[model samples]
Target: MLTAKEIDEQLSILQETGRKISECFSSFGSRMDFKPSPEKWSARQVLHHLTDSEIVLAYRLRTLLSENQPKLKAFNQNNWSATLAPEQEELPLMKSCFEANRNLTIRLLKKIPASLWEKKGVHEEAGEMRTYDLVVRNTSHCLRHLEQLQKLTEASQAVKL
Candidate 1:
């Protein structure tokens, strides 16, 4: 169980995610498609993953709040990236989708009662988790990929092409 203060901090981080992503990608300029290697994802692909993750996490959060110990499904992100062809996705549209969904989720989080944050759910792979756990996990996931995007931008700059 997280303290109220801790939960507030986590929510703040979640709210800033889309803005931070835009800031990080601003440095990438024309290198959104630049991958470190053929096997790895590009900045664009990471954006797609983050957007997709926000949508999935929102659904999980809603389920946890509305149901009693609902079983949450796990998604294969790598497979989504490969099959979705994020490299071919339009940057503006992807960003809009991410920001819009994130905004709606934030609004929902803010309006929910504090006790609802403790609502529990069972994830297929992660086992039992509280709604607050999803909040923390999702925020950390966003920050990790934000750092990845920053590193990708640096690597892209280093490459002549």
Candidate 2:
């Protein structure tokens, strides 16, 4: 089990994720909405998805920490990306929203006792999920989107050459 301090450190990293993503795609602002294919999501869409995910995950985490055997809802990310029309939103706004939402989560986590980390919740899709699972999943989720954005950037760079 990860200690509270360790978890806090991880939370801090999560808080900075938006800033890192913003810097990584600063040059791609003009083309942040560019999708290499009809099936692919652009950097802007990814940011919007991430911001929305943070909001959902924050609520999920709070449920696990405060409730016993909470049943979490499942969301189809692709549906959100499609309906949200993220391509029309400003990139910085999406990134800033992600950072702000994540900060709220981190602040809440800092207040919870370490023992609460073991509390379990029932996710509609993933079945059993512990508080610790949420933390690990959050980190991986952000990293996965970051990797996707990186690939998108590389593809655009190739086209520029």
Candidate 3:
């Protein structure tokens, strides 16, 4: 069982992720579409991936909250990036979706009783996961991508300078 302080800290990081992503996007300027190589994902793709991931997270949480031992689905993000995320590059809209969904998820999480935090879901690929596990997993996932965006931003900036 995670301590309340630990849970709060994770939530705080998750909340900050959207703001950090927005800042990174703002800083990207001309580098918004940059990719380090042919195989690498550009910032726009990452943005879309994050947005899609958040949408999935919301659904997963709802399933966990309402169902007993729900079977969770896993997606191949690389495939989604190639097929779905590239259709549009509307940064503002994507940003809004990401932030709004994240906020909604956070609000929903706050209302969940501590007893329910351990609600279990069996992911197709990841096996068993608790509601709290999703929270921690997503916090780390977002932070990793935020760092990736920052580095991509710097790389893109350097090339243009």
Instruction: Give me the overall lDDT of model 1.
Output: 0.85
Model 2 poorest 10 in a row by lDDT: 18-27
Q: Candidate 1 or 3, higher lDDT?
A: 1
Q: What are the lDDT scores of the predictions, listed in order?
A: 0.85, 0.80, 0.84
Q: In terms of lDDT, which candidate is strongest? A: 1
What shift in Å separates residue 125 of candidate 1 from its native position after superposition?
1.1
Question: Which residue ranges in model 1 land beyond 4 Å of their true spot?
Answer: none
Itemize residue pairs with steric clashes in candidate 3. Answer: none
- Backbone clashes in each candidate structure, one number apiece? 0, 0, 0
Off by over 4 Å in 2: 4-9, 24-27
Give the Cα error of residue 49 in candidate 2, in Å: 0.6
Alpha-carbon TM-score of each model against the true structure: 0.94, 0.88, 0.94
Sort order, TM-score high to low: 1, 3, 2
Per-residue CA lDDT of model 2 for 1-161, tens digit only, reads 76767777777767667567657546675677778888998887777888889889888998888788999998999988888888778766766777777777877877887788778999998889888787778888888888898898888777752
After TM-score superposition, the amount by which residue 150's alpha carbon in candidate 1 deviates from its true location, in angstroms, is 1.1
Compose the digit string of candidate 3's lDDT tens values, residues 56-161: 9999999988999999999999988988856476788887888889889989988888877888999898889999888888888988998888788778877853
Model 1 agreement with the true structure over 48-69: per-residue lDDT tens digits: 8998998898799888899998
Please state every model's RMSD to the true fold in angstroms. Answer: 1.3, 2.1, 1.4
Minimum summed lDDT over a 10-residue window in model 1 is located at 21-30
